[model samples]
Target: MIWKELKKQWRFMDGVVIASLVVLSFVPLVVFSMNHKENSAKEGNIAIISIDGEEVDRFVLNEETKHKEKTYYPGKDKYNIVEMEGTKIRVKEDNSPDQIAVRTSWISKPGQTSICLPHKLVIEIVSGKSSDEKEEDDDMIITY
Candidate 1:
């Protein structure tokens, strides 16, 4: 009697496993098909530096060759060095224990960013040019 019950339940378990496998296969395809847009500071070739939600400085990456800016936070001894090399930008030196920002790769893209969370500082590349000014249609889009 026990063997019969076990054999009957095995079929239902097998169906559940098969259904799960089918759903898993489709998950990756759906994820890959969707285009994820990043929120960017639209200021063109400029990098915005903000500290504690306030804009502290902005740098034009193209004109600026190579330099470093030290950020000092009041009441805190922590400091972060924002470095720019050619068109690339990164946190070159940080006193934070993890040094995650220092370890991050340099970014050159218009929308790329590097952050030092300990100092509450964010560095983001911007286009400087507003997208709203262009009213003409471009060939980059395709319609059915």
Candidate 2:
């Protein structure tokens, strides 16, 4: 019959088509799982800024409204303005060429960071806990 003839002609590609569809279905699940893990691990609201490998400033992101610092590095006079509204911190202004740091969006989590390579500056969000408290918490988690 015509059906049998058609099946015989397409048999070789049937498995390949089905396998590709199955793999494509799992891609969205994997992407959403990774995004969930990153969001769940968010832990802090303190912003720490470092320039040239030295700690330059620290601000409680929720307490401060705004802060601006001008930096002189060798031949450049660069600057950054940090603004915090409620619990979020973001780079409101930056003098870097590409302005990547200023465009990085707002952050309020422990591991979040914004960096400007041309100016050698890095801003990181850190947990509010003291080192001793953090060490004890880590030990407890391991024991559990």
Candidate 3:
């Protein structure tokens, strides 16, 4: 007798319960999609083009030299530059390991003082050409 009474109550509430669950599930999916879109849009390009017309795809700043060199001081943050034939991309620091595709025009021209990219801006430049063709050829000569 008690079982039948409880079953009747549950049957009447079934529609409401299912509707609530469906709404709950939908909320998270919506939130997740929005979050993913925001994250994807934030990723930026990382590259460096020297004033001397030299393009370096992969570069690592000597930590010691970086500390001493105030000219290329990257402030407190860490960054990397990905150098291509015609463009240089700047990648900001983040914990996540992901590549950002950035398409930006060059702002600093050759023969300009303080032209070297900050040491913190280390980036991996992708090249399709042969190794010899992808040499670090820059017109700006580094004088010590």
RMSD of candidates 1 onward, in order: 8.7, 7.4, 18.5
What is the alpha-carbon lDDT for the whole of candidate 1? 0.72
For model 1, state the Cα shift of residue 38 in Å: 21
Q: Which lDDT tens digits does candidate 2 get at residues 58-119?
A: 87654444554443342357677766675577778877899988899788777899887888
Residues 1-144, model 1: lDDT tens digits: 999998877888798999999999998877754522122222337778888889988887663456655555623788877777766788888788788778886987767888888778888887645566444534477679
The most accurate candidate by TM-score is: 2
Worst 10 residues of 1 by lDDT: 35-44
Question: For each candidate, what TM-score against the reference?
Answer: 0.56, 0.57, 0.25
Clashing pairs in 2: none
**Per-residue accuracy of model 3 over 1-144 as CA lDDT, tens digit each:** 999998777865798899999999899899977864453334322223332244433332221212111122234543333222323323322322343322322222212122223342333433323356436543576889
